[model samples]
Target chain A: MKKTLFEKIWERHIVDTLPDGTTQLYIDRLYCHEVTSPQAFAGLRERGLKPFRPGRITCVPDHNVPTLNQDKPIEDPVSRKQVDTLEKNATDFGLAYYGLQHPRNGIVHVVGPENGLTLPGMTIVCGDSHTSTHGALGAIAFGIGTSEVEMTLATQCIMQRKPRTMRITLDGQLRAGVTAKDIALYIIARMTTGGATGYFVEYAGEAIRQATMEERLTICNLSIEMGARGGMIAPDAVTFEYLKGRAFAPRGAEWEKARVAWQNLYSDEGAVFDKEVHFCAEDIDPMVTYGTNPGMGIGIREAIPSLDSIDEAGRISFLKALDYMGFRPGEPMLGKPVDYVFLGSCTNGRIEDFRAFASIVKGRRKASGLTAWLVPGSRQVEQQIRAEGIDAILTEAGFALRQPGCSACLAMNDDKVPAGRYAVSTSNRNFEGRQGPGARTILAGPLVAAAAAVTGKITDPRTL
Target chain B: MRNTFTILTSTCVPLPLENVDTDQIIPARFLKATTREGFGDNLFRDWRYDESGHPRPGFVLNQPTYKGDILVAGKNFGSGSSREHAAWAITGYGFRAVVSSFFADIFKNNSMNNGLLPVVVSPEFLSELFASIEADAGTQLTIDLPAQTLTNQATGRSEHFDINAYKKDCLVNGLDDIDYLLANKEKIERYESLVTSYKLQVTSK
Candidate 1:
């Protein structure tokens, strides 16, 4: 049968097809973090069984680990125990670990790319939802649960049901002032979060063709928000170029062979998809989220929409969103007060993101009433920002450059918006209280984050 | 305890929204501890409990009439950060399964591997389940794993569901990947030795 690249990889990984039409899939890699692994390891211990493919499983401590402290034991007892447990589990289980102060230690997603562990035509699973961040390298990556973490650790393969496929092709040059982050927000806004349900989406377009790897990751990283099981882009020169000199990439003559193999990872012409959506990049602007969901967003210039225009069935949804967000109908999101501004996460926290923010905030100070925290996604990102003078620029502008972690994005650590405070963030989700209880988050790009810091309002970066 | 797989059809509580995230399932505040117990009570903690930790009257789970082991949710259930506590809370709270038109990749995998079934039904079937659950909170459903069908005994209608064969095998036989590998340790040892020898050959070459 004719197949897409997705089909070929999936077919190669299929262990069996069940009586009920679900295929038993095999996992290639299992990535886990400190927070979710302890219970899973205990589950394994209770069963008196050891990991089957320890070499294929890797562990990292990110979520609960404070970004700043490296030399000392974790201050919080609970967090200390979580990190300690991961180190012990990884050690006892024979899995590779990037413990704190390990040169490679960083956010799991960032480490995956930097290590060349996320390769073309691979299946990657992590006990972290943003595992889709690995898909930027043309791998099929999805987040798994702690039990599935144990499953992969024990067997190196996870039982699975394949999702249907969706292809979202955006084919035009983007307008100025719009970055890949805007493109992703635009796609989610159009797709309504559930649009890609039960599907793995492949993003292909002229705009994507021009996007740097960081941008591809930014798009794929948010696939979960659009209701995709995950998202991927086929490997091309850009993929090979990014991997050529990486630490884990194939070397010498082997590199040539790997490139040849990767070239075959693209979707074939006339491939049939379960669903397809298209967008013209020209239509997208510097998009920012309005209500509590990633899907509830608009171009920066647009006003917050009134609920009346939607279908009657959607009125409750619109009203619920407004109630949760304390939003008024037909009000422009511009000049909306913000208590905080966050500039980090798996989304938009790379070196490019920092450069964008530093450029905007270099000469200007953060808004007097607002607290701006700029966190790098990885130590590498933080190092680059510091080396490139981005951190200095931020510091001079009254923005504190936080150490790297998934800080304030989900409030997994100390950085979180307090109850009833409004924040402008560059993270993926803006769900009600995603930053903290009753913490209303408006998702925007880094440029907009800087703008929110400077103006203390959810203003358009383009207008800045 | 002998590992047991009891096929249970959950009584549905209607949660009507797409993309219900992990934070909504079990908030971060409830996940602070390394231990997994006590979280079941705090499942959907902020939403389920009022500011003083009193039960919120408007919350769906608190509505006295809708009681059951299964939760039928709208599309994109369990979306957001990979918080396994969401699954733990659901399972700890005694939910045997979750029926949804779609489950986020991470949450579904977590649910299935942890012995909590994530039953994916067609949207049409999901709507029917929601309608039945809403119209009659006393609705009792049967999830037959061997049959791969979710049947509403009251309505006498069954929706076909799918589970991966390996998961089905393990679930029925109560064999996790570790248990299965242990049962075939000889083959694994041989494969490991083979990999070791292969590396030696490559290095020598």
Candidate 2:
């Protein structure tokens, strides 16, 4: 039988299968961050175990580190302690450590690909849901819990029951203002957040192939939002080009050999998928989430669904979400005032995203009523923003660029939006208080966020 | 010792909201700990307490009339973030199992890894389970791990749930993946030697 890209990577990494039906999947790369690794390291210490392959592991402190003041100690005592724990753990384990203020220090997912640590035809695991972002290079990457983290550290292999496969083919070209983020939100809205559970998705067709590597990463990063095990697009010229000449990527003859292996990473011509779904990219619109979950989204010009549109079983929760957002069921979301704007996360924190945001706010001044936090994904992205003069344009538009970290995405640092205030965010997830305790977040693409920062409300980017 | 899960009979606390994500289970601010203890006190922290740090009497967890070892929630529970902290919070708050019509993939794995059972029932069955709890807080549900069945004592309705055979065995035996992997170290090494290496090792830029 022919095999899919996921199966190709998965089968190659299988070490063994137990009588109880669990396969031991070997992981080529394991990324760790401060928030989740401390406990795992503590477990290793208690068990008197060491990392089986320390060279394959990489660590960074991003979740709790502040986006400002790289030179000063973290003011939040608890946050500082966790960052300290990770540094100590990495040092004791002899792993590559990227502590706060290191040039490579950033969100674990962002730095992996940008630094060329993520590669095609490999199995990657991280203690973060956005680890799926690495699958854009045709790798099998997914999130695992800390117990699995300890397992990987002790053995470099994790037990798993394989998931079913899905193929989501996005055909044709996207509309003028519709972006990769919009397409992601569109798919999640259609899938209703749980539709893809128990499946590993493979994104294919013209639209997916046409997307830039950064755009592809954004698409795969949201695979978890719809409950997928992970998502991937087979490596092509775009993937190879994105990895070429990067700091950690292979050079010369080794690069040529690696490219040849990556070229065969696609699904065979007659490959079979357990399920398949199709969509036209032109059907997607600039989307904005109106309620608590990522699935509660609509086209920018649309109104929030009325009570009658919701099924009786879900109406209570639906109404509760609207109430938390301070939105009525029938209210139009377009002109709803936005008090804050956040422009960074693993999902939309790439250089392309910064370019898109700058495209909209180049000449226009930011709304005086809104407080905007424009952060880069990594120090490299920050340096690029300056080299490309994007920072000057943002400053000229009255927006300041903050240092790199996973700031405001989960509000672990001081970049939180105050309670009950509305924020137009380019980051993923709008769960209640995700941006801050009781802070209302409207999830959107970079262009939509830029539009909101200028108008101080949820404005359609196309209209602006 | 508490890792072994076999049989449980307990009443349930009903959270009739869909997409109850991990962030709501435990907010990001409280994840600064270096260890796993004391998370239960802050489970559902924002919802259980007000800005003034007082209990919200209206929340299901804070109500005196409802007390249980099970959490019966609406569909699509634990939908965001791969934080096992969410599972830690649930287990810490005294829930051995979470029942819903659906669950996110990573959360389900995390729950089972921590010996917290995730029971998936039909949509109608979950709704009825919530209704039974709302009608009377003392209603009990029995989960038989070996049989893979969940029974509602109030209505005497039963449903079969699915779990990975290996995970179920590990949970029943109070075993974990690390133990199994540690035992099979030689197999892992042999397999690694036979495979063609695709890894690009770089110590620094």
Clashes of each: 1, 0
Across residues A1-464, which tens digit of lDDT does each residue of candidate 2 receive?
A: 79999999999998998786679999999999999888999999999999999989999888888888978999988998999888888888888988777888888889999888999998999999989999998999999988888888889999998899999999999989888999999999998878888899999999999999999999999998898999999999999999999877788988999999889999999899999999989899899999998999999999999999998988988999999999998889889999999999999998999999999999999998899998899998999999999999999999999998889999999999999999999999999999999999999999999999998988888887
Best by DockQ: 2
DockQ of each: 0.36, 0.74
Model 2, global lDDT: 0.91
Q: After superposition, how far is residue A189 of candidate 1 from its true place, in Å?
A: 1.5
Worst 10 residues of 1 chain A by lDDT: A15-24
- TM-score of each candidate structure, all chains considered together: 0.91, 0.98
Candidate 2 structure quality by residue, lDDT tens digits, B98-117: 99999988898899888899
lDDT of 1 by residue, A1-464 (tens): 56676786787666555575665456666777887778778877877868766766678888887766667777878878888888898788677887777766778888778767678888888877789888888888987777677766666665567789988999989887788889999999989877776788899989998899998999999888877878899888888888888766777887787788788888888888888899999999888887877888898889888777766645666777888888887888888899999988888888999998888888998889887777888877878888888778888998787777777887867787988889989999898778888899999888888888898887777777
* Candidate 1: Cα lDDT at A217: 90
True contacts kept of 1: 0.42
- For model 2, the DockQ equals 0.74
Task: Tell how far residue A151 is off in model 1, in angstroms.
Answer: 1.5
